[model samples]
Every structure is written in C-alpha cells, then in structure tokens.
Target: MSDMTAMELDEASGQAPRPLRERLSLGPFSDEWTAADWIVGSASVLLAIASAGFFGWSFVVSMKSPDYFQQAALANMPPKLDRIETGSIDVANAMPVPQIVRLSEPTPADYQIVMVFNNEALLATRNELMRVKVGSIVPGLGLVRTIDTEAGSPTVVAENATLHGAPATR
Candidate 1:
C-alpha cells in the first residue's frame, strides 16, 4: 500500500489547509436568528414602547391635578402692604392710576404690582395686616389693600399701585 501525499488528498477533496464547511457564518438564518425569533423580538419592543407611553400619561395627569399634587399656600399670602410695598412712582394718572410696586418679604425686595383699579383707593393704617387670596379682585381687577393700627397714630393713603395679577377693589 502506498502512503498518499497531503497535497494529493487536498486536491481530490477540492480543499486546501482549511476545511470547506468550517467558516463562521454571520448571515440571517445561518444558524443565527430565525424569522420567528425576529418576529418575537419586534413584538417585545412594541410592548416596551406601549408600557412607557402609558406610564408617562399617568405621571402627567397626576402632576396637573391639585388633589394629587397638593397645592402649596402662596408665599406672599396674608398680604402685607410692606410685603408688596411701592418703591418709586414713575407714572400716575387719574384714570386707572398706575404705580410701581415691590415685594419686601424674606429680604431683598422685588418690583411687582399693587395696582389701584377703577379709582379705588388703598388706605393703610399702622400695625394692621391684610390678607389677599385667589378671589380678590376689584371692578377693574388686580387691586388690594389692608391696614391696622396698634399705637394711637395711623395713616391711610392711596399712592397708585400696580400689581402683577388681577386687582381687587376697595
């Protein structure tokens, strides 16, 4: 019996040093992911998207609802003339008089409005405190004033105030 050469065997099998069927295949359906597997994967992705959308909608609704969110009391409530006091009067008119205002609560004053709507006057007495709420509007709107006196002397005067929100009448 004659010993066969490696070259002769390879030629007869039409293969060199590497095996013909030993390549690493990465194509679809090549022992990798099948059509059924891909379909299931897509369905899972859709379910995840749907779940996220539902959760997002619920979160938004909860945030908007006062009952769910628990509304906070206004910081500038129990409205004090000092809290929203006038700084410097730039413009004043007899008809719907306008004045510049600023909040002086918690230090560092901020300019806002404490308007005198419809010729309504705001008379403040010494030591007296006023509280303004949601339903505090004058004939024109966004007008409010309060006052009280502890000692013997107090004063009530109108300096034409301007406010950010709706005004309350006298």
Candidate 2:
C-alpha cells in the first residue's frame, strides 16, 4: 500500500486542490478584483439605492396628493355620461311631435275572451267546512262573478270558492 496523503492522491490524479478562499471567491476569472470591477459594483449599488429613494419619494408624493385615489378610481371606472350636446336652446324646435298612424277604423274584436277565476287563496285556508271542492256549495257574500258580452261562453267554471260565514254589519 502507498503511504500518500489526500493532497498527494489528488496531485497523483492530475487535480490540484484549491484553497477554501479561492474556491469560495465570487469572480471566476481572478482571486483579486480590479479597480474597474470595484467601481462598477459601487456604482451599481449606488444606482439601486438612488432608484429605491426615487420610487419611495414618488409614492409619498402620490399618496399626499388630494385627488390621487379619486383619479385612480375614475380611471378604472366606466364613463357615466356618454355624449353631451353642444348647443341646445330651442326646446319647441328640438321636441318632436308624435304622428299617429291609423291603418284602418277600429273594428270589434272577433276573438272569444275566456274568464279566469283565481281560487288559490281559498285553497290555502285550512278549514274543512270553509274549504271548497269541485261540487262543494259556496255561500255568495264576497264572491263576485262578472258577466261580459266580450267573454265568449256563459259556461260556469268553478274551482275552489271562498265561503264567508257571516256578513259584516257596520
């Protein structure tokens, strides 16, 4: 067995071990930075600081502005009034008179008018005697049945009808 160290083994393997400082160095070119590199780095840092300061100042100024938020909100919002008239003084001349178009003289309606009786409220009441069915007798008190010649047939179509027990006396 060869009595050689790790460094000797590395050397034997045609690879020289670098120093910790050199290995951890930032630049790949050289161990020491040039004057130009230092100047450029300092300038970059100074430029970054200056840019940050400018941005902060601008933000403070915008926040201090009275109509800043209002202007920003208005910029995002849709315009309320679309178009504005420039000159409008004469109301009589501007107003348009409606023209009635009469095609022919008004004729009597020929279509049969069907009457609809709504008994939804009476059906909703929870009284067995007061509740109306198909053939149930309805007391005529508040019930109103209107007969019109415009309505087609005089056929009685009764669903559930509301039955008032007593008449109101005032």
Candidate 3:
C-alpha cells in the first residue's frame, strides 16, 4: 500500500477536512445582517400586526352594532312577502294564457331524419339541408340520426370501408 497523506486521502474520498469553527456557522446572515434587511423585516412585521389590528377592530365594530351590520347585509336582498298564495285566482288572472292548441300527432312534413358517420359528413349534411328545418339529433351506437320534417333519405358513412366503398360491417 502507498503511504498517502491526510490531505491526499481526503481528496481521494471527495471530501475536504474543515476546521471546527468553519463548520459551526450559524446561518446565511449569522455574521451580521445588513441595515436594509433589518428595515425590511421590521416593516413586514409592522404591516402584519397592523393588518391583524385592523381586522380585530372591524370585528369589534361589527359585534357592537350587529343591527347595523344586519341592515347593511339585507339592504340589497329581495323584500320578504307576508304570505305566498300558490295557484291563486289573482295569480292566474295576472298570467298570460298561451293561444297554442295541442296536437295529437305531429305531421310528417314537420321534420326529417338524416344519418352520418363523422363530423365532416354531419357538417356537409347540415349545409346541404340548410333550408330544411331540423327538430332534434339522436346519437348512439356509433350512429347519428337527425329528425326533421323536410329531411331527405338517411345516408350512412364510415371511416373504414371495404371494397366498392361499402362499410365492412352491417
């Protein structure tokens, strides 16, 4: 074995020996804090105390004059009614009656249904049937169908198709 000095051994071990005093440093500002650091810290403490005192004062004021606070809170609230009369004759008289008559069955000319696969085909169909008034759209089982009175025959489109442009599945 080669005779290695203490410093050489420490260097080989990836560590440098330090004196006790150097290793016992308190913290970053242990030596002495700057005047600016002291001023900023004092200001921060004072601001926190002032904010707490202001909140305490507000709480005391609110507790002393609870009625004032309550009035302030209720100032923008809706007025309380003495009694609520549901389905009353006066309410019925005030309401406007609809003139529409109920129909037993909807007419075929009222709506139409169109089926498409992807969003692009749906947009194209919508553009083509712009004049036709659509009622509602039902989407399920990987199929989308439109309900409208003036819609043409349903069309089915799929992303993956077999030979001759026919869908692979039924």
Candidate 4:
C-alpha cells in the first residue's frame, strides 16, 4: 500500500517468484542437495510423473474402448434375437454365436427349440452342449404311486446358461 507494487513488496520480503524454474528448493534453502533431499525430490517427481502416466493411459483406454456400451439400454429388454428358430434340432452347430438366442425358454408341446450361433469369433464353442432331463408332471407324470415321478422327460439344463470367452491376441 505504500507506493510499492505487489511484485515490489514480494521482492522486498524475499518472497518473489522467478523460482521453481530450475533446481530443487525449500524454505530458505537453494542449491544444496543432500542424500535426503535427493531422495525426497526424486520420489516426489517420480510419483507425479507416474500419476500423470496412469491418468493419460486411462483416458486413452476409455476413448478406445468398444462403442458397444452405448447400446447398454438394450440389455434391459429381452435381447432382440438375430435369429429365433423353433425346432428340435440345434442349429447353432452350423453357425457361430458371439451373440445367441436363448432356446431354453418354455414351449407349448407343439414346438421344440433350436439355437443358432453365427458370430465368427466364438464359433468354436458352438457345440459345447449340456442337456438336463426332467421328469414330466412331477405331480401326475411320475410312476403309478400316490407320488408321481418321471412320467415324461424334461431337462435340468433349461435353467442353466453357458459362458464362453472368444479368443484374443496381444
């Protein structure tokens, strides 16, 4: 306030800028480098650089990540089937399915289900099949006793789904 510019006052109080441009410094300390000082300075700089590197890598990955997530809203609905065929044969063998139609849904006795796999990347897993046999009419389809058993054959596999990872290269 006394006719001194802010910068001039800083200079008078020995707190001027024009530093941190080079060399390590601390309060009242300049060009002196000790073992502890070196360790502290090196570690701090290394940590800052490493943090920056990690943040940059994360940003790049986020940018390059698959655009599929934009369609995440679709996941909330019953998947729109690429192909849905109702039959006794498993059609998935002839095709590849990175995406699949779930044939495991219950059906009226008139029609059976078929699954087709057509995604090239996951084609190899097209034939890994699991079958579960359920006894029909557990209440009535069973044996001729007061308690019923396997009157007809249903499958336990209906309730289960499979997971397969397509191969990848580095």
Candidate 2's C-alpha lDDT? 0.47
Q: For residues 1-170, could you state the per-residue lDDT of candidate 3 as single tens digits?
A: 27986556667889986555445556877447667888998999999999999999889988898687778879979876644444335665576878634343222232233333332233222223422213223221122233221223333322221111123233
Q: Point out the higher-scoring one by TM-score: 1 or 3.
A: 3
Model 2 C-alpha lDDT per residue in residues 29-110, reported as the tens digit of each score: 6557787988998999999999999989878978789678678888999756533354435676666878644454221121
TM-scores, all models, native as reference:
0.23, 0.24, 0.25, 0.25
> Any runs in candidate 4 off by more than 4 Å, and if so which?
1-28, 66-136, 141-170
Per-residue C-alpha lDDT of model 4 across residues 21-135, encoded as one tens digit per residue: 3323554554667789889999999999999999898678668875544556467678444544533455667666487455554222312223222211111123333221232
Specify the poorest-scoring 10-residue window by lDDT in model 2: 105-114
Compared with the true structure, all predictions reach lDDT values of: 0.44, 0.47, 0.46, 0.41
Model 1 RMSD in Å is 17.6
Instruction: Report the candidate with higher lDDT, 3 versus 4.
Output: 3
The C-alpha RMSD of each candidate to the native structure, in angstroms, is 17.6, 20.4, 22.7, 18.8
Q: Model 3 scores what on Cα lDDT?
A: 0.46
